[model samples]
Structures are given as C-alpha cells and as structure tokens.
Target chain A: EPEVTQTPSHQVTQMGQEVILRCVPISNHLYFYWYRQILGQKVEFLVSFYNNEISEKSEIFDDQFSVERPDGSNFTLKIRSTKLEDSAMYFCASSVKGAITEAFFGQGTRLTVV
Target chain B: AQTVTQSQPEMSVQEAETVTLSCTYDTSESNYYLFWYKQPPSRQMILVIRQEAYKQQNATENRFSVNFQKAAKSFSLKISDSQLGDTAMYFCAFMKVMNYGGSQGNLIFGKGTKLSVKP
Candidate 1:
C-alpha cells in the first residue's frame, strides 16, 4: 500500500526561527492537505492544495504559514517565524478525489518550539 | 460549518471483548462522509473504516464495523474481538461532499477517544 511520507520525524526549533516541514504524497493523489494537532487537542485543518495552488485555508492558517507543491511529489509547509504555541504535530494527507475518497495520512512531523 | 464530536475521552476493554466508540456530527449537507482513524503510540494515523452518508448500509472491515444512523447524525465504531494491538487513540472525522467551484474538501476531526485493550 502506498503511503504519504514526511521528513524529520521530530524537529526542535528556537522561537523566531524558521522551519520547513516536508511531505511526499502518493504519486497518483491530486489533493494534498496540511493539518495540525496540539497536544491533547483535536486535529485542525490548516490548508488544502490542488492544481498546484491553495484551494482553501482555515482561520488558523494565518500569514505565518505557507504551503507549496514545489515539485511533482513534494509538498511542504513553511513557518516564517516559529512561536512557542506553534509546537504541535503536523500531518500531511493526500487523496485521489476530494471528499469522496479516503485521504491517506503520513506518520506526522512533531515540531517543538522553544 | 461542520463539526464532529466524540463524547468518550477514554475507554478500556478486555482482550477478546467487544468495544464501541461513540461519534456524532453536525452537518446540513445531505452528502458527506464519516471515518474512523486509529493512532497508536507510534503516532501514525491509520484509517480503520469509513461510511458514506447516502448509503444506508453500514460499512464493515473484518472485525471493525460502523453503526451509522443518518437520521440521528450518529456514527459509531465497533471493534469486535479486540486485541491488545487495538489499543490506540481513535478519531472520528467528518467531511462534506465537494461541489464544483466550492471549497476544497477538508476534514473536521473530533477530539479522539483513547482506547486501551488490556490483556
């Protein structure tokens, strides 16, 4: 079974620093998404990407966050300046079709900001 | 707006026993999808099962099954013959069907239920 893969299973960055979390979605998937989960909280949708552009984003996805499908398979999330509250697990997911199809998730990248 | 709610924060079941996790959602759209995902200590999200709102017949995968009540807006997951490996945090998620030129389909997930299948 093909699965989404994320890099740097764990990352620790200082406050005000920049960090880039990367993901490689399944080859055939066209829709990609980024989600965040604070410790002990529900997972929240950050943004969705399709056709190499952002399709939708949540309120939490503010100016500090940006996503890019830099290449054919690589999808990345970049934080301009990390804040302490930004510490959480970031998940990458992809699906063949939008809501009707199952979205496969990656193992997640745990970001810890100090 | 769409929301998914998992009332149970934690649950435990003896090995080989049956366990059910509750989930309820609020959505005006008649067409949607619901899913159950498992996250073990490894922190990997695994899709356990999924149910389509338009389909009255519930979905089942091996020992994992769902009891979906469209009228009540309820979708519950039932794990039969639960094994120790079944211990994990279970999340219920909701997604509204996408319409052409509408917002991208994004999932709204509930606070997960931490399930422990003890030996």
Candidate 2:
C-alpha cells in the first residue's frame, strides 16, 4: 500500500526562525491536509489543500502559516516566524476524495521551536 | 462547526478480552462521516474504522467495528479479542461533505483515548 512520507523527521529551530516541513502524499491522492499535535494535547487541524489551492483552514492557521504544493509530489507547510508554542508533531495526510475515503498519514515531522 | 468528543481518557483490556472506545460528535449537517484513528507509540495515525452518517448499520472490519448513531450523533468503536499490539491512542473525528465529489473537509478530532492491552 502507498503511504505518505515526510522529510526531516525532526526539526529544531529558534523562535522567530522560518521552518518549512515537507511531505510527499500518496501518489494518487488528490486531497491533502496538515494537522498539528501539541505535546500531550489534542490534534488540531491547520489547513487543507486540493486542486493546488487551500480549500479550508482552521483558526489555528494564520498568516504565519502557509501551505504549498510546489511540485506534483511535494507538499510543504511553511512557518514564517516560529513561536515556542509551535513545538509539536506535524502530520501530513492525503485522501483520494475526502472524509468518506480513508486518509493516509505520514510518520510525522517533530518540529521543536525554542 | 463540528466537534468530536472521546470521554474516556484511558482504557485497558486483557489480551484476549474486548474493549470499546466511545466517541460522540455535535454536527447539524445531515451528511457527514465519522472515523476512528489509532496512534501508536511511534505516533503514526492509523485508520481503525469508519462509518457514514447515513448508514444505519454499523461498519465492521476484522476485530474492529463501529456503532454509528446518526440520530444521537454517537459513534463508538469496538475492538474485540484485543491484543497487546492494540495499545495506542485512539482518536474520534468528524468531517462534513463539501462541494466537490468527496471534496476534502476539515477534521475535528477529540482529545483521544489511550488504550493499553495487557498480555
């Protein structure tokens, strides 16, 4: 089975520094999403991308956070200025259609902001 | 807005016993989807089961099954003959359908219930 893949398993950056998390969604998937889990907290939705554009985003997704499908396979989440609270596990997921369809998730990238 | 809630913070079961994780949601949309995802120690999200709101019959997959109540907005997961390998954090989520055919919808997840199966 095809699985989502994320690069830089772990990222440690200082506050105010820019960080970009990359992921390769399932080859045939058309919908992509980004979610974050703060240490010992509930998973929070950030944004969803489809047809090469953002379809929906949660309040947590702000100007500092942006997503891009720069290439067919590469989907990225860029944080313009990281904050201490940004330290968490960032997961990238892809689904063929939407919720009705199973969404496959990557191992996740642990981003640590100091 | 949609919100999913998993009341149990933790649950345990004997290796050969069964376990049930509870999940409930608040949504006005008649058409939506409910899902159960498991995150192990590795923190990888694994799809455990799913049920459509319109389906009155519960969905079952191997040892996993779901009791979806569209009227009550309740979706609970049942894992029978549980094993140590079933230890993980289980999350309940809700998603509503959008414009496109199965267009991606935002997910609202519960705090999650941690399950530990002992041998």
The candidate that wins on lDDT is: 1
Q: What is the C-alpha lDDT profile of model 1 across A6-78, one tens digit per residue?
A: 9989999999999999999999999999999999999999999999999899999999999998868899999
How many clashing residue pairs, candidate 2? 0
> What's the DockQ of model 1?
0.67
The candidate that wins on DockQ is 2
* Candidate number 1, chain A TM-score: 0.98
Q: Assess each prediction's global lDDT (C-alpha) against the native.
A: 0.93, 0.90
User: What is candidate 2's lDDT per residue for B2-73, written digit by digit as tens?
Assistant: 888899999999998988899989988877778899999988899988887777889999999998878788
TM-score of each: 0.96, 0.97
Ten consecutive residues with minimal summed lDDT in candidate 1 chain B?
A: B96-105
TM-score of model 1 vs. true structure: 0.96
Q: Which stretches of candidate 2 lie over 4 Å from their true place?
A: B99-101
lDDT of 1 by residue, B1-119 (tens): 98899999999999999999999999899888899999999888998999988899999999999999999999999999999999999999998876662336688999999999999
